[model samples]
Target chain A: MLTLAQAQTIMTTALAHAQSAGFKPLTIAILDARGAQKLFTAQDGTSLKRGEIAIGKAHGAVAMGIGSRALHKMALERPYFVEAATHAVGGSLVPVPGGVLIRDAAGTLLGAIGVSGDTSDNDEAAALAGITAAGLVGDTGA
Target chain B: MLTLAQAQTIMTTALAHAQSAGFKPLTIAILDARGAQKLFTAQDGTSLKRGEIAIGKAHGAVAMGIGSRALHKMALERPYFVEAATHAVGGSLVPVPGGVLIRDAAGTLLGAIGVSGDTSDNDEAAALAGITAAGLVGDTGA
Candidate 1:
């Protein structure tokens, strides 16, 4: 189970990384293994839809049981499959790099983190950094 | 515009109310007036869909520009209209009393709060108490 404190720690470290890296304002979402949101935050200047986008990334990762980087590749290789998958996930799937799965040292899935409001790579980097800070493995499907 | 600090304050106070009243575990959602989520939390042990339900309540109220208590009445009086309106809101409307609109003392709409996992009246009461603690007016359409 992902404790709320762990989720809060992940977000705090992620935002700190974003700040130090000089990324744009960000919106971040954390979801437990069941795909239920645990914590969410949108920076003051984030665009209106950024929060949904961030949640979509995290939700998609958890729903598909894969990191969103793989989903992005699938989207390119087979658009039709991604389209159907999107519907199956209730329209909350954003196939992109920023959605990463969190796993334990034993490869047990803990949850996911999604970040938005910067380049997809930068977003993913921030997420990975946060997961590392929490002493968890971040699987970006690389 | 609703500040994140205010949103945090609202959630903190609302949860305090729920705990004091011995309500069931809750999922709470807060949205800015533009219908974007600002903050969300699902207490431990909340059912799988409680978070979505909480978001639906707040999103529906903001979408319809009225508190969800009013939407519940509209649902009873004009079921078809309510049905259509639900579709218009992208299937996130929960026409129930737990969704309350937040407004300044001057009646300017700021945002909304939604709480789920207890009796609707109790949920609305907690939301109202939170808004009051934040020094904002909570319009439950009563």
Candidate 2:
């Protein structure tokens, strides 16, 4: 089981990366297998909107069982499904930046991480660092 | 400016109280003034279903500038406005347990918290813990 400590480490590392990269402050979230929040953080200067975007990305990854990039592509191909999910989930299905699937070395689905700060690419990179630092594998979908 | 630390601490204390009270596992969310995420947590056994409820409550509190309990009452008295907000926010309006406004000592708007667990009352109690822990005032709608 992924402990809250591990999730916090990922969030901390991700935020550190964002700071080192000179990106805007960010918000990060990690969710466990059952879509429960394990850890979440928002940096000092991060816009309030970034927090929701981060959660949406993380929530989207956990709900769809895939990295947000894949979900994003899926949304492009099947806008209707995305729309339906949006209505069904009631605003938790955000298919945007800073979300990725987290897995163990043996390929078990553990959870997900999301980050929001600079551009989507930068945010993705920061999230990937956190996953790697925590010794977790992330499905980047690219 | 509500720091993330304050938000997380509030949520942590709230969850602890909920667990001590033997309530069901929960999904809880907090949002700052700009409607961005401040903190989010899902207890060990909380189902994904709770996520929607929690988010809806938080969103409703922010959108209506009132506690969700008040919104629930208003919904009964003015169904049209509630229904319209439900549609306007892309289906994120929830006027039930687990939502409340966060205010400063002077009653300035700071943020909102939403929770989903046991009953609306239980959820409200948890939200109250979070708000109080953060040194923010809250109206439980009771």
Candidate 3:
């Protein structure tokens, strides 16, 4: 189980990296292995629905047990399957690079984190940085 | 009925109020009179589901044509009716104090704002303050 402290560390590090890189205002969501939201943040200037997108990215990663980067590829090669999965998950799946699954050193699934606001690649980099800063491995499914 | 600028004003003011009052991290949602989302923000470290709760509060207010405080009383006094209404609104109704209806000086409904993070009363207070700061009237259905 990912503790709140760990979740906070991930969020803090992610935001710090985004700020240092001068990315756009970001929204981040962290979900535990059970797919429940653990922590969320939306920067002051984020546009509407960024929060939902962040959550969807994280939620979909957890629901499908794969990083969203993998889901994005699946979405390309198997569009129908991805669409069905999106519906099955109540339309919360956003196949993109920003969502990454989190695992501990022993390869135990911890949770997932989703970031939005910057380019998808930049968002994914931020997620990876956060997970690494927390001493967890990030599975981008790449 | 509300512009994005107005929505941002409400959000900024609401967050300012929450901070000055030393309330917990908050999540806020602003919805137009047509029930479309206008803006949303979740402070860093907000708990899971707060975003939904905030949206539900505002969405329910806009859908029912009343503030969520009134909805709370309705939920208590006519539980079945409120339950049916909740279902009718696609299960977005959250009868609580933090949901408020926004109106112009001419008493035209412009939108609704929902807040979550602190006690219900404090949440409501923050909502009202935000609306007032935006130069709008807030109907809490009190």
Candidate 4:
């Protein structure tokens, strides 16, 4: 189980990575394995919709049991996949680059994290860094 | 009508109840009648998944007009019901005991609350206590 403390630490580290990279203010959302929300916060100056976007990404990752990066790739190759997932997950499946899953040392899926604010690549980089900082593995969705 | 203050109070009191019982850390989420998020937070040591479970429970309760405990019981009696709900609701329904409906003295539904992290029974107890503390009615979904 990825405790809230770990989730917060991951989020904080993710934010720091974004700041270090000179990215814009970001919104972060994390969910447990059961798709429960463990943590969420939006940096000041970010658009209101960033939170929803973050949630969409995180939920998409959780529901599909894959990273958003993978979903993004599939969506790019097959647009219908996005539509189907959106319909299936209540429009929360955002095929983006920032949503990734957290895995423990034994390769257990602990939860997911989504980041928004910067470009998709930047957001993803920040999120991956955050997961690594939390001593968990972050898949690239490949 | 549900205010953010009231939502926060309910979540806070819910956590207090869990703490009083020496239960595990928890996450709490509340939404208004329209299913808009009112407030959410996780205890320090709780898992990240608790928040999402709480949300699913709360959303499930609101969408079904019954407590999650009721859904849980129904799910036990009818397994296919869970699949149908997941499809109809876009996968947010969680047939768990932690989701409960909040009503006013006049029996008007103000919103719903979802709690997670501890055992389902403990989560339900904490959520009900919080509702009572907020001077609202907490339906047990029976």
Candidate 4 lDDT by residue in tens digits, B1-142: 7765577678779977887899987878887787766566777666535566778999999999999999999999997987698689878888989999999999999999988888899999999999999999998697
Global fold similarity of model 1 (TM-score): 0.90
Which of candidates 1 and 3 is the stronger one according to lDDT? 1
User: Where is the poorest 10-residue window by lDDT in model 1 chain A?
Assistant: A1-10
Superposition TM-score, candidate 2 onto the true structure: 0.77
User: Candidate order by TM-score, highest to lowest?
Assistant: 1, 2, 3, 4
Quote the lDDT for A6 in model 2. 75
Q: Over 4 Å off in model 2, which ranges?
A: A1-6, A16-23, A31-40, A51-98, A119-122, B77-81
User: What does each candidate score in C-alpha RMSD?
Assistant: 2.2, 4.4, 5.2, 6.7
TM-scores of all predicted structures = 0.90, 0.77, 0.68, 0.59
- Our model 3 lands, by Cα RMSD against the true structure, at 5.2
Q: What TM-score would you report for chain A in candidate 4?
A: 0.96
Please give, for residues B62-117, the per-residue lDDT of candidate 2 as tens digits. Answer: 88788899888878999998899889877987987579888889978888888887
Give the range where candidate 2 chain A is weakest over 10 consecutive residues by summed lDDT.
A89-98
Cα displacement (Å) at residue A106, model 3 = 2.0
Better of 1 and 2 by DockQ: 1
Descending-DockQ candidate ranking: 1, 2, 4, 3
What DockQ would you assign to candidate 1?
A: 0.67
Q: Per-residue CA lDDT of candidate 2, range A22-108, in tens?
A: 988788888887776776777778764776688788888888777888778878999999879867776787776569888999999
Candidate 3 TM-score over all chains jointly: 0.68
Supply candidate 1's per-residue lDDT for A118.
98
